[model samples]
Target: MFKYAWICKNPDLKGMARRAILQAMDTKPYSTWLEIDLGAIKNNIKQLKAMTGTRLMAVIKANAYGHGVLTVAKAAEQAGASWLGVARMEEALNLRAAGIKSEVMVLGYTSPVM
Candidate 1:
């Protein structure tokens, strides 16, 4: 069995209601998993672009920190990121294969043998 709990010092009623609904939903038991809000990523990217007033790069290295590189990269690009940064040539190649058109920078060294 899985237990879900939300503890907050100042709880908003609406937020509590939402949390209750989420807890009621069926989910498989897993030792670990990730729940990513892609909309939040996009919104944050937009906010950063607005604040910086300069081109921004969305680093999707390490599979976007395990949040799915392709999805995160697309959201970041759509939200006005001028470039995507990856840690390796393979990661950049994967993005290109996925039809990601944004400019990509591999911040790590690539082996000549590859």
Candidate 2:
């Protein structure tokens, strides 16, 4: 199995590259994946609101714990999450790209020197 790691000229190709990598990985002895249910997330958020009676904030850091950050954030927003938490600026940027208007907080460390 070949581990392909390369930067593409077109940024949008990254997802395609990821798929190719996964397909290549299928030949490996071990692999992993996570299945996320947006319906479940919405239901859970509703339950939290009912129990706490307070606005809920969702932490989607670490690529939403490997559950696709954009999908989770959108569901969370629709489910009444006032804010989304991310550990990297890239994650926040991705949320913005997805047209998410909810506030996104970056919990990762930043350098002032830049």
Query: Which numbered prediction scores highest in TM-score against the true structure?
Result: 1
Clashes of 2: 0
TM accuracy, model 2: 0.69
Q: Candidate 1 lDDT, tens digit per residue, 1-114?
A: 555566666669658866777777758687986789989999999999899899999998999988899989999989989999999999999999999999999999988897
- Model 1 weakest lDDT span, ten residues long: 1-10
Off by over 4 Å in 2: 1-33
> Alpha-carbon error at 60 in model 1, in Å?
0.7
TM-score of each: 0.70, 0.69
Write the residue-wise lDDT of candidate 2 on 8-87 in tens digits: 78877988888877876775565676677799999999899889999789999997887888888989999999899999
Which residue segments of model 1 deviate by more than 4 Å?
Answer: 1-29, 112-114
Tell me the whole-model lDDT of each prediction, alpha carbons only. Answer: 0.90, 0.87
